[model samples]
Target: MWIATLALCLDEDYELIDLMEQMKREAGVRENCFASLGWLLHAKGEYEKARSYVQQLLNEHSLLDEPAIRLCYSILGGVATAFKEYDESLIYCQHVLKLCQKCGEDAPLPVAYQDIGEAYYWKKDYDLALEYEQKALDLLPEEHLQRSYIYRVIARVYRATYHYDLSLSYHQKVLDIQKKHLHENHLDFAAAYNSIAAVYHNMRLYEKALGYLNKALSICKKSLPVNHPDTQRIERNILRTINHYNRKRQYKVSNIILLYYLKSLKSDLPDTEHETCSILVRFLFDGVM
Candidate 1:
């Protein structure tokens, strides 16, 4: 059991697979191994494989303990969320919430709440998202590590609703906690900075937005490989902000049409067209075209 658990601790999940068969003969070992393996597979993006383990755990004959069963359902919900199956994810998360009630184990309730909120967020129901996230926030203590994520999610919902000040407030809350707890080089700084930059972008505070974007970009360049998706995404955001700042004009159909022709002549890429289109938007916004 120690060896099996250690395998998971080291993130050598492949080593756990062979041990699972041998552990199945043991009393408590097999279930823990299964749960850990399921979570590992999910995190690795092996969604189908993770689903199989979770399904087995939830099967009628399994009779796994309440906490174990709840974990499996949560993993199932997470996998669904990863695949953007928010409706299905909500059902699984709801199941976990029910389990938490039945077992008198309220500790997992906050996580279930967060999962529900996240599902609503992805579904574009900003109002519902805020409600559920606020529930999670209320349940979580300010000192709890997970509150950072809840704050970030709430911030995102506010941003989507164009509540710029509220979004910045929540994002600042996250930063306040993160600065005290997380190391300076932690990847979360990138997310925190990006979130702040987005709010600034919405407010048309381009200089502040650009500053935060650069901060995120710098962290990504140091922590992630240049070709990493996260790094690329930050680069894209920086480009977008720069383009927006350069085009100081309101939206005008006339400018957009001109941008389309200019883009067609200059570059065929849809993204290239978009970059040029922002310039046209600026012309319209500034009423200079």
Candidate 2:
């Protein structure tokens, strides 16, 4: 179990996932494997499967201990958040928070606050989102790796509220924390790059946005499955940003200004030649001559 915890923290998930599955086949170990297996599956981005296992854990045990219940709720809440079920996410996370309060457990408090903060973020309540995420951050030690998650949520809140500088600052903190724990090409790095790209995009800095987006896409390609939703999402974002850049560049060439330029050019050409060129310009600009 200690090795399992280490495997999870270190992102050595494939072997840990296999070991957990094997443990589930054994008799007494099966009961103990559920929460760990559920969390590991969630980390692997197998959300439906994670939910299935966690739900099974809840149903099989009439009376799970506090830690098991907290893990179960946390996994379910995270899956709900991934699926955009903010209300359900809030319910599960709030339940965990209440349970912690009743049990006088302080250790899970930061996790509960982070989870609740994320749900509020998706619900577009930026004030509550920042407040809860700040509470989570305050609970964490300065160098704690878990602070990265709280920093990310705060970054997203800032991004949504149009505070680009603050968003970038928090995102930088997230990257700094992740770099210390995760390898250079870790999928978490891809997520952080993608987040920073989003901030640049909102700031209308398309070149910087494109640069970060490309880095994120490269990492995703190296790590995630070909058809993974995250890979496809980054692909779509790249296309959208490219389109926006092209449109912005096109807007810089004012239609009236271009027509005036053409009129001036017409003065220096024969009427027949000018008419031919003007027709081409009109067709190109209006899609009809």
Among the numbered candidates, top lDDT falls to: 2
- The global Cα lDDT (0 to 1) of model 1 is 0.74
**Which segments of candidate 1 are over 4 A away from where they belong?**
1-33, 41-65, 217-232, 246-289
Residue-level error in angstroms, candidate 1, position 272: 34
lDDT of 1 by residue, 197-287 (tens): 9999999888899999889888867655336556677789999988888774433456556767665667666876676777766665577
Stretches > 4 Å off in candidate 2: 1-32, 62-64, 103-106, 253-273, 287-289
Clashes of 1: 5
TM-score of each: 0.65, 0.80
Whose TM-score is greatest here? Answer: 2
- Candidate 1's error at 145, in angstroms? 2.3
Question: What TM-score quantifies how close candidate 2 is to the native fold?
Answer: 0.80
lDDT tens digits, residues 78-131, model 2?
899889999999999999898888777444788789888989999999899889
